[model samples]
Target: MGRPAIEVQGLWTQFGNQVVHKDLTLAVQRGEILGIVGGSGSGKTTLLRELIGLQPPSRGRVCILGEDIQRLSAAEQRRLSQRWGVLFQQGALFSALSVFDNIAFPLRELRTLDEASIRDLVMLKLRMVGLRPADALKMPAELSGGMVKRVGLARALALDAELLFLDEPTSGLDPVAANAFDELIGHVRDGLGLTVVMITHDLDSLATVCDRVAVLADQRFIAVAPLAEVVQLAHPFIRDFFHGERGDRVLRAAAQPASSPGGA
Candidate 1:
């Protein structure tokens, strides 16, 4: 279709003698949520890190918003960072900072906006994530796991970024809370028209929020159009993940299409 918001072609990442990704290629369209799933140590996080410029890939290209990030000048890279936001595992909020401060941290660092403007923006973001104004004043440690995740989400939206990256957004929450979080992701993406790249273990989240998913296996990510197609992947890790013993029924139900009673 249109030019992709993020494109990774022939990406290869390595750690000493260990190769994490080999000839991996994928692309994320604008204003769409792309979920990445794989077993632990399958290099999902490694892929995300390289995409964000935290680590250099051994080979290949990453083009975000039409520019190769790895070849950019330092100033250009900084500018690119401002246009994107990330939520790491564990919410990664500053333990010492209040939730309000944590949310405002990015705005304070990147923008010329004054205190009043910053507060207004921060409050808006917090509210978007279903957090009350009063909740922002509390220390991050005082928040529940779900609340902390919301706060982290608020912070990621602080800059009004065009692109967002979430690493295991549902890692610590219970099933109910995780479902709620997935709904929130859907709402936020629609409300903001932002492209999302999420690395998630939660299959329900994939069915709920993702426009498409890429399964990482055998050192490459295979893009699958729908959850049903993904479920049929022949790779051991892919099959084990999509149709694993623990929750096959739920996945099957989630992937099923609704049918009418009368025959056509």
Candidate 2:
């Protein structure tokens, strides 16, 4: 296999005297959706920030798409950053910008496309994320929770980057909307041939969409495997997480056979 799409070696994150990650190491394969799950304060978000160069780690090497981010010059890092897209936890849309402009932001930053071309690309991305072209004129304030998430996803895809980092992508949606969003994520990943790293607390998402799940606990990743295998680990967190009533219900639902359309 080629080099991993993302690699972390002996990673450590410290704030004052508190250490969040210690000797953490991980590798994400190309074109795979890797879900990160951890309890509260397990530093899941911190790890995501570190991966995207938003937060620096006290000790460790982070290699993204084969380049070490810590070693990159500012200009080089800026260029490297364009190779991946990030969907922040809250969608992070500019309240002042319309949806059209939000998705167009990244494309416009390139400064190579004409207005007509930018508009065309923006509309294309909207359609790609299951949004109507007419909806592009609406501001973030006018959008529903699911719409906000879709807009954020559309903006993330505007660059056509090979990597996507999603921080709590389905956090605020209802069950139905969250399921639809999960389906959209799988569709987009497969359609774009993208490598996805998602930090999600949604069990249904981890069960249905993730190719593999990474469990974060006690300051590092305890296990990284397919959900089935990870749930089998003997750790207390794994037991509490997967064997709990809600977790068991979700897993049981995930394991059942899909009924055929129009079947009894």
Candidate 3:
């Protein structure tokens, strides 16, 4: 296994009188796809935000790529920010920008590439996400939900980040599209050697792309292990989650051996 790409120690988060996480500790290995799962309000998103420095833990340390993000100098933070990309739950594209320009936004903001190079890169990203060159001319309002997600993914990968953060990457898609999207994630993970941290309610995603699963419960993670083992955990939530009807079905499908398994 590679060195830890993300490390959190003694994490705590609170809002008003509500405590979300308490004393959570975790380490995500490099090049691994880790699924963050829990019941509706288990602090899954909170933890993601904290790890990415969007929200500060009331008490804890978050270190990414060996630098404590909270402690980094402004210049260091800027450089670190370039190392990863995030796909929000909703496709948060700028309505004013065309699809191609949205994909190019990061490159324009972060690098010195000229318009020609940027256009070439944007085209490549569009193709990488299985989007047509023609789709680039469409507005965000003109795309389907799945296309919107793909565009968001293309934009996230625009800068060639080493790490990718996805919030419910498959939510709101039909089963077939969701399945294809899962494979796409794995495709990019291997092709780009990217470490992926995804927060999802999709059990099949955990089975399909996640190398490990982290279950958040009781204000912290109950376990972080391979899906097979995580399902067998003795916690009530874990039992109810994985042994439930839908979960059991998806997990069974996931444990099946693939003849050519190449996608995420």
How do the residues 1-264 of candidate 1 rate in per-residue lDDT, one tens digit apiece?
Answer: 578889999999888999989998887888888889888889888899999888889999999988899899989998998888899989999999999999999999966989999999999999999999999889987989999999999999999888999999999899999999998988888778888899998878877677778888878876546566777767777666776664576466557672211111
How do the predictions measure up, each by TM-score? 0.93, 0.95, 0.94
Better of 1 and 2 by lDDT: 2
Task: Rank all candidate structures by their lDDT, best first, as comma-separated numbers.
Answer: 2, 3, 1
Native-to-model Cα distance after best TM-score fit, residue 259 in candidate 3, in Å: 12
Candidate 3 deviant stretches above 4 angstroms:
257-264
Report the number of the highest-TM-score candidate.
Answer: 2
Lowest summed lDDT across 10 adjacent residues in model 3 is found at: 255-264
Q: List lDDT for all candidates, in order.
A: 0.85, 0.90, 0.87
Q: Candidate 3 overall Cα lDDT vs. reference?
A: 0.87
Query: How many residue pairs clash per model?
Result: 0, 0, 2
**TM-score of model 2 relative to the true fold?**
0.95
Instruction: Give each prediction's root-mean-square deviation over alpha carbons.
Output: 4.4, 4.3, 2.5
For residues 60-179, write the lDDT of model 2, one tens digit per residue. 999999999999999999999998999999999999999999999999999999999999999999999899989999999999999999999999999888899999999999999999
Candidate 3: the clashing residue pairs are: 183-264, 186-264
Q: Evaluate model 1: give its lDDT.
A: 0.85
| Model 2, runs deviating above 4 Å | 253-264
